[model samples]
Target: MHARPEAWILSIGNELLVGRIVNTNASWLARRLTFMGFNVSRIITIPDSIDDIVLEVRRGLGKVRVIITTGGLGPTHDDVTLEGIAKALNKNLILNSEAYEMIKEFYNRRNMPLTRERIKMAYMPEGARALRNPIGSAPGCIIEVDSTIIVSLPGVPREMEAIFEEEVKSILEIIAPKISIVECSLKTRGIPESSIAPFLEHIAKSHSNVYVKSHPLGFELDKPILELRLLVSATSEDTAKGIARSIMEDIIREVLKLGGSTSSEYCV
Candidate 1:
């Protein structure tokens, strides 16, 4: 069987590295991509240096099918993500007319003056398609290099999310069709991760298609509460859900046998 297409997330910005901002973009992208049936292999954070950005993008390219980068696509001098990407792909940074118009319209509507600094947001790597940013001034860009898709989005969480939901999501669905991802969790009290490791291992080994994980929910009194997450991916929703349900049932039975009492059970 062919392996699922893999994805990598690159969060660019000096602020991320300096701990000025939390890197929530990687987490959001990972969850979204996983739901879309892509395996997120790695997430890398780098400073706002053109050399560093180029190096990271080059490394991710050819390794993963999709690379989503967030941050550094701004009007300030530090915003050099487009330059780095163009350098990495041996392309030129050109004024994207569509992106320029988008930014222009945004500022024009707000009665803001269009300055040279603001126009810098319109530049993108050559042959890149501009993705409309509904909530912000900077437009995202998408480029394909050697069969790998490179997507660059704004650093602002709100703008990134808007562009992703409105544009990137559909592009991803079209490029790498969606699979049914069914997941269910069972909460067990008075059980620790150590105690449930063997059962989870057994279930995972037996049902290769199902993913089993144990999350410890801290301590209640002296014992650790545990949540077992079961996930399965299939061509159809019913098939995926049925497999997840069956695997969850088996794990629950094992938990009960191990003297752990179950409390809540639900699909997610």
Candidate 2:
């Protein structure tokens, strides 16, 4: 009944900016958030600068309901995401007892001594709650500012995904309880995107809850090929699934009418 919550993703690290490492975190988060019935508006990639991080966080908080940042949560000196968050929210950087305990246990299990750098990971923005990272030493954090939730996760793909699945997913489920999203994809062999553009536009306009997109795969012989993706969000699973099925049927019918052939089965 209400509009979907808007989300913004921020990726921080000089490695991402300089191409030293690929920024797969943004794409992963975007896809997951979209499938969870969120309107992912923008993805921003910035260097590991405290000022830039603080500025972006402040700006994103003004617009989006949820902001997720990946990277810069390590024990190294360049790991300044917590500092930026604290500065932006006017909160003090203090030792979080929960985070300290988690870090201590993790290091102790590995028989690693607690060094100064390792201790830095326990300092988080005041009033922030730590999200346990089962796979890594750096614990993620969540803080609310002006009713907007900001989540900080590690840069490593494995650790980030673990924290998101184990901790953040439950929080989001509670925040947006009424949304149910369903998606279906159709792969066609002989249809060009240009030919199906008008039909997709019409379907999108007529069905406001349904999102139709065409992705052009490479040509097969002389024929242009593409995949059609359909997504729907509703208050219930049955409604969402039904809408997606109906849309897929309509698309298949149109493709057949246009003399185009499909090589793949409908996937939901």
- Judging by TM-score against the true structure, name the best candidate: 1
lDDT of candidate 1 over 79-124, digit per residue (tens): 9999999999999999999999999999999999999989999999
lDDT, candidate 2, 146-251, per-residue tens = 8789999999999999999999988987775477888788888788899999999999999888888999988989898888888788888898888888888888
Task: State, as a TM-score between 0 and 1, how close model 2 is to the true structure.
Answer: 0.95
Residues forming the 10-long window of minimal summed lDDT in candidate 2 = 259-268
- By lDDT, the best candidate is 2
Model 1: lowest-lDDT 10 consecutive positions: 1-10
Candidate 1 displacement at residue 207 in angstroms: 1.9
What is each predicted model's overall lDDT from 0 to 1? 0.89, 0.90
Backbone clashes, each candidate:
0, 0
In candidate 2, how many Å is residue 42 off?
A: 1.4
TM-score of 1: 0.96
What clash pairs does model 1 have? Answer: none
List TM-score per model, in order.
0.96, 0.95
